[model samples]
Target: MTTSLGPMAPGDIRTRAQIRQEFGGSPQGGICPSDEKKSVNLYSDPSIGEHVGYYDGWLAEEDELGPVFEYTGAGLTGDQTFDGPFGMGNRSILRHAEQGRKLRVFIRAGTIKGTATATHRYVGTFNLDQRLPYVWRKVRGENGEVRSVIVFRLRPDGAFKSSAADTIPAAKKTTVEFVQFQPITASMLNSGPATQGALSLPSQRQGAKSSARKRTTNASTEGVFVVSEAFNTEMSLRAATAASIAVRREAALTKSYRAHLEAAGHTVGAFQIRVEGLSSTLRTDLYDATSHVLYEAKGSSSREDVRMAIGQLLDYSRYVKTDAHPHEPRQAILLPAAPDPDIRVLLERHQIGLVHQLSDGQFTGPDFTAPS
Candidate 1:
């Protein structure tokens, strides 16, 4: 007789036995594939001992897009491959997106309130992030040796309820190289071979609009020491998505500050610095022509926000000098409100000024003097 399973919604709790009865899959493994329904169930248990090398949990914080759930592929030691017995779980997840298979996620909760049986909290359906599907990380294996493992990036299809217990503690900051996979189709095979070309650098300054791309040339006949253009590809994508509430607040803060500067009769603009050999470019938030100051704006006054603003101000100061401001522009940070005393001291140590908006809609900061 077919089992009649009630509707399972996001944030609902279900036990392993009930899940197996509703969805036909093994109760042992982390990845359960149901061939009859073409769906996959992903299970993550934080209670599992780390000695077993099971590092599955939600990323510490959400990005501008949304919450990211990281699931480690199956394997105990050595390099994890996608071919043999251990490969079944990893392959099922990797092909889920391309194969149009549905993914239902669950995280292990301690146990039902009054019962000893374990329960899993449903985390809603998710899909592999197209921009970055997976990143390889080195973690200790079951044998006490370090080995590379695949960590898939899964984004929720809709609303996601976050739980502190399911979040992995923030790890030491390390460079993560993301791998992007694109499905090959018949149309792509029939198309001509793709061509590679150098990025064209514009040589003329555009209008005074903040989004306009401009090329700054050295006044000296030094033969164009550096080029500055507007780099907004990533920013444009972020603006289009408008997913993260934090990102929206930051954008609003930036816009308000720009309007304040303009109202005060100050010439303000932004720049994207591009060096000859580098493919990536650095973009500044605001450049004051009247006072010759470079201001990096942040929505919040948190330590992390202040730290990022400090780095951007220092980095952009190097390339912001032009004919109008021959020397490196005085660096400063713009914030919605004053940061902590320690943050103020930190900014002072770096010789960077701080500007914050007051309740009366006025800005207060160090005096900006034209560079001599």
Candidate 2:
């Protein structure tokens, strides 16, 4: 990894927009210098969320290490879970070290007590600490649900720390409301790095061997990569909760389900479809285009989870599209384990299907009658 330049200089502090404008980048695509890779990626945390409230500021404060801040990954609707070295925002920042660049962070420290346009303060440019690099913290999301989010622990490269007077001005409170603001907006998701595509199964399997299992690395056929369900959940939770546990369990269940379907010669993948009233698109967890079956995956088979998945699949089935038709796909819930008999009976009554993982990691079912 390349050596970091150090904490941002006092005079280098600037709003995310100003930094991007001068550096030639967008809120989504990430900022960089005029030269392809010379500039730093600026992360703006306004500390706003519908459920989580103004959390980024507090998380940044808890850090006793000088100039150290826990900057979150991008994704406003859910928890921002890191997807190895392939995710955007936080993961992208790590690349700066390899590419010989820097990551500058800014936090919204509302200058006035009750105002939202409060100018941001420059925290500093930091490098990820190889040890204890990240932690799963509980955070709120737009839906008011709490979930785990990956917060990267970054340390200042050189001797520098923003004074309390500079980091948080006098007369200003430490808390801020979760408000819709610039640099951190809905459109920002659309502006994510072109290289950071959504996770999905490759259209063509490398081999027909049932034992072949690997992470999907190829970009979509159109060269577009949309974020996967796990990462999406991470981004969403990041915006809502303040604490959560390991996210890999949830991701593993989904991957296991997807892999099982593929090995059986059923093409399975996450598909993006437009919802009737929503501006942004909704992605299905596992869409079998050929069979017109849509699956919603849950890490657990508890009643609460099964109920939630049922509702989501029903909602998605109504407005989702396939084969250029607004055909209601056969809806099913995929779980890590089977739910109670009552839950199964309830699902049968509704004609919603149930698929569960067996002890051996194999997926079974869609075992209910399809809704007529």
Alpha-carbon TM-score of each model against the true structure? 0.46, 0.43
State the lDDT of candidate 2 residue by residue for 210-296, as single tens digits: 211212232222111122433322222111211122133455677676656555665445554422222122445666644667788
Lowest lDDT block of 10, candidate 1: 222-231
Clashes of each: 0, 33
Clash tally for model 1: 0
Error of 2 at 54 (Å): 27
| Candidate 2 global CA lDDT score | 0.47
**Number of the predicted model whose lDDT against the real structure is largest:** 1
Model 2 segments more than 4 A misplaced: 1-40, 43-91, 94-246, 273-281, 324-326, 367-372
